[model samples]
Target: MKYLVTGTAGFIGFHVALYLLNRGESVVGVDNINDYYDVNLKYQRLAECGIDRGNVSDNKKAVSSKYPEYSFYKMDLADKAVLMDIFEKEKIDVVINLAAQAGVRYSLTNPDAYITANIQSFLNILEACRAYPVKHLVYASSSSVYGANTKMPFSTSDNIDHPVSLYAATKKSNELMAHTYSHLFNIPTTGLRFFTVYGPWGRPDMALFLFIQAIEKGQPIQVFNHGKMKRDFTYIDDIVEGIIRVADRPAKPNPEWTGQDPDPGSSYAPFKVYNIGNSQPVELMDYIGALEKAMGKEAIKNMLPLQPGDVPSTYADVTDLKRDTGYQPQTSVEDGVAKFVAWYKKSYGK
Candidate 1:
């Protein structure tokens, strides 16, 4: 089957594409490669897929040498014309949309970016899927959507109406838009609400990468909420595995779904939502200690108040995912951090 995987230059997308390629599946990867963080890191990821960084230009297409069945294109989902063209040409069987303007704090400063990338771009993707009916449409949601909820082990069945950040709001909107498509056109849509995903080749903007960089440079690492934060730090490999499993299984209508007693997780249409997370919440201090162990250096700490649009803790209830896909996030924080540190040292020649 031919897959169209967006955000090919991103950490998760790169890993997912590599996994599919290794399994001898054909993939047409797409990315705008925006300079949201480090463009060099994005280029490095593309290079791993055998795409020459020098050869990539706006809207250009290239093939990978490492995996002959894999190809890539520099395109934005907001560009409906280009997106539609690709869909028409590639004859894509399945689509995995992972591209977006991703930082919560950044959204506070640049709200328009989220509107264009997350909202507009996502609508374009939905339209394309409607026009060219694919087998399945799998997209990324966030645990941030559970904003303002103090519930333990956040569940898909919980209400996500009160989002603390614009970024989170957009993700919730994506879920709504997906449900509309599924209801209107019978498109098989699945939304995966990812928790704190971290591992090798991770985004520099993420906490794990920032902490590792600061600790390595002997700089003080900022501890938000006075180190009272807790997260379900899921490993990248586990996330990719869950994604592939879901991609293979198209969503089915919930026969028991009724307007009287509605479950937010499923619908009468072919729409579903699942929490893809470690299902284990670790304290912030413990995560830092694990990083210190991996780097062999104690980090100078700078305790600070929690910033706006930030949640103190996040714990996911991945019961639905496990029930459906037999999914289990097996990587422990210690092992995951060690693997990330090793990759960081090797990548930067520290």
Candidate 2:
């Protein structure tokens, strides 16, 4: 099946698109290549898939020279006219929506970016899917949606009405909007609530990348929540593997689901939500220590309080994913951090 994977230049999208292309499946990639992080990094990801930067232009499709099965477009999801045109022309079978303005703390100041990118852009994707009619629509959600819940292992069965950050609020809103589309239009929508994903070609804005950068430069890295926080840090390859497995199976109506006691994950409509995480929570200090070990340099740590819109810990209960898809995340923090540091050193020539 042909797949239109948005955010193709992104860390996850690049990996996912490559996986599909390598499997001999057709893949169409989309990304605005915005300067949310390093634009050079984004371009390099595209180059890795054999897409020449010189051949790429705004809203125009460019096929990978090495992998002819893969094509890419530099288009913003918010642009309804252009997006609709691509949907109309491409005959896309499935859509994996990973494009978004990511960063919880960044949302604290730039509220409008979240509205435009996450809310508006996702709405556009749903509408396009409705119009074009794809077999399945898999979109990225976040573990941040489980805000204010002191639960040890966050499960999809629990309520997600409370969100601390506007970023998280928009993600929860995406799930709601997807549910509405599924119920009203019978769109097979599956929402994947990703945990702290880290690996090679990871986002520079993420904590792992930031800490690694600071350590390499001999600068002090800020240890948030006084290094007391915990996270279910997933590896990128593991995430892509789970994404493909989930995408291969379209969501179906749960016959057992009733209004008397509804399941937050599955419904009578063609909708489902699953957490794509390691299911293993590691402390922030432990993560840093792992990074230090990987890089062979101890980081100068500046301990600080937890910022607003930040949760002290996140642990995903991926029981539903495991049961339905046989999903098992295998990377430990130490191994994942080592892989990331190796990639960082190679990419930066450090």
lDDT of 1 by residue, 117-168 (tens): 9999999999999999999999999999999999898999999899999999
Q: For residues 1-350, could you state the per-residue lDDT of candidate 2 as single tens digits?
A: 89999999999999999999999999999999999888999999999999999989999989899898888999999999999999999999999999999999999999999999999999999999999999999999999999899977999999988899999999999999999999999999999999999999999999998998898889999999999999999999899999999999999999999999999998999999999999999999999999989988999999999999999999999988999999988888899999998998898999
lDDT of 1: 0.95
Q: Estimate every model's Cα lDDT from 0 to 1.
A: 0.95, 0.95
* TM per prediction: 0.99, 0.99
Pairs clashing within candidate 1:
none
Residue pairs in collision within model 2:
none
